[model samples]
Target: MTIIRTIPENEAVGEVAEIYADDVESLGYVPTHTKAMAMNPAAYGAFQALIRSVAKPLGLRRYELVTLAAARGTRSQHCRLAHGAKSLKLFDEEQLERIARDYTGAGLTDAEVEMMRFAEQVGRDAATMTEADSQRLRDAGFTDQEIVDIAIAASARVYYGSALQALAVDVDTPPTLGEPLRAALVDGL
Candidate 1:
């Protein structure tokens, strides 16, 4: 049972309306993930803010890279499917499949794999992190600030993914995008 009602795209108002409009224009639909957050405008807005705050500092690829790993680590198909769709824009089918099955086996560059490993750890147990963790990222060429940003991005995904899952928000529908990855999104769903 859904613990919170999702706001229909057309019925959304104010911030939700604006956000929904952007989603529809860019992705073709209001993602179920977004709709779930729309149940509480404040929470939805906060999610948006958190994302924007990291946009420049983390950049899209790195941020999504960490996020996808964390999503998989958390066993959240909702997040995995969504972030997996976004990742398809940058990576090939085989690479994405590897990431889906196991990032370490994906043949990603050492730096990329290291980032995913860090994100997975953050998702699994942040308490386990130590100087060695920072050293690993440093060895991989990530600066202290970048490491913090990666951690923040990975940690933030838990909020929406868990909430949507707990609220039983749907993820069966694929996001709207065109070209090479459109089918990939469907496959992810």
Candidate 2:
């Protein structure tokens, strides 16, 4: 269990209850991360809005890929497992396994690889990034807007992932994730 004391689901009301309801409807259970964030429902709502805004223009596949890269860079096992399972909607098992193992050799397009690398770098070290980094994304065929979106997606992940880590939230392994891919993300091999 997390060190934080969250609103218990049974006693939840108002925004917290609503948040729990939405998760229960979509995910079939309330995620531990959701419960942790719901300690401050308004802040949690704002965070969700930020994620939706970033995801809306980028599309699900791109967001998940960028998120996975960011999670990997930060070594956030929770985000990695969660997003890795979400990525299964877009990629086959073999391809996802390959991406988890090594995305460079996973047969992704050059543009895709560049964006993931950029997202990883953002999570790993944003301060060290220079204009040349943005230029690399541009060279990879991304527009300024797309590059900005990728950065936001990656940076936002650091915020969320850091919160989970700080609270020592338990990693929720989605059942949809296969063993090999799970092992790769969780075990880092």
Candidate 3:
């Protein structure tokens, strides 16, 4: 059970309901994470806005890759499960398995692998990131804007993963995800 009471979509009023409705319409279901976030409407709105503003401009695939790396580095079951599900659409079963096992060997382009590595580094040790890290990303073809957006994406997962863990929010195991990705996230949990 969740530590924080999740507000039902029907019980939410005004903007909350509106946001929930749109989410449900887009996703075909209201995610438990969103409901948990609804406890603080302002925070939820800001978070949702940040996700859209940062992620939409970048390709969803790239953003999802960063999210996956951060989720793995942080060991957040919720993000690992959720983003893994989304990743299946972009990667094949064998590729997803490789990513879950070891992203470095997942057959990604040099730029993508470098980005994931950078995201993991930020997630694990943000303070330790040096000028060389930034230079590496720039050399790997990430522009200044993209680097900033990558940081935002990684930072967003820190809050999101921690909140979901604290709330004990259940990770949804959608049928589309199959077994490998699910196993990757919920294996020890």
Candidate 4:
């Protein structure tokens, strides 16, 4: 359980109420992370906007891949489970399990593998990154814009994921994710 107190769904009002409503409508239940972030609605909105901006250009498939890699690197099981479940839209259970186990050996293309590698680096330590990282993506045929989007996507995850970890928020497992894949994501390869 998290140490911070957050607005309860029943007592929510204004933007927080709307955010909770949207989550209930979409996810059938309010996510714990939502409650934690909703402690400040403005910051939560800004975070959502940033996530939307990152996801738009990369599209959902690539976006989820980068998110998963970053979440893994951050050691954020909450994000790993969330993004891993979202990844099911792009890959079957078996394939997703393979990815969660070892994305490099998950039959991804060179470009995709490189993209994930870069995201992992971003989540792990962006300060340590050098031009060689971007150059690798360039060699993998990613445009400068795509590269920028990838970096932001991963960095954004680092921000949110790290915050969630700091707060010690409980992980919310998606009901759709099977046990094997969930274990792979939560327990690592």
Among all candidates shown, the one with the greatest lDDT: 4
Write the residue-wise lDDT of candidate 4 on 1-189 in tens digits.
899988889999999999999988877878899899999999999999998998998999899999999987898998998888778889998988888888999989989999999999898889999999999999999999999999999999999999998999988998888899899998872
Better of 2 and 4 by TM-score: 4
Report the alpha-carbon TM-score of model 4 versus the true structure. 0.96
Full ranking by TM-score: 4, 2, 3, 1
The candidate that achieves the highest TM-score relative to the unseen native structure: 4
Candidate 2 lDDT by residue in tens digits, 82-163: 8887788899989988888788899999988998999989888899999999899999998888889999999999889989
TM-score, every prediction: 0.86, 0.95, 0.89, 0.96
What TM-score would candidate 2 get against the native?
0.95
Off by over 4 Å in 2: none
Residue 145 error for model 3, in Å? 1.0
The per-residue C-alpha lDDT of model 2 at residue 42 equals 88
lDDT, candidate 1, at 107:
78
lDDT string for model 1 (105-187, tens) is 77788998999888887877788889998789999999889888888888888766777778887664464334334443334
lDDT of each: 0.75, 0.88, 0.81, 0.91
For each of the candidates, give the backbone clash count.
0, 0, 0, 0
Ten contiguous residues with the weakest lDDT in model 2: 180-189
List the pairs of residues colliding in candidate 1.
none
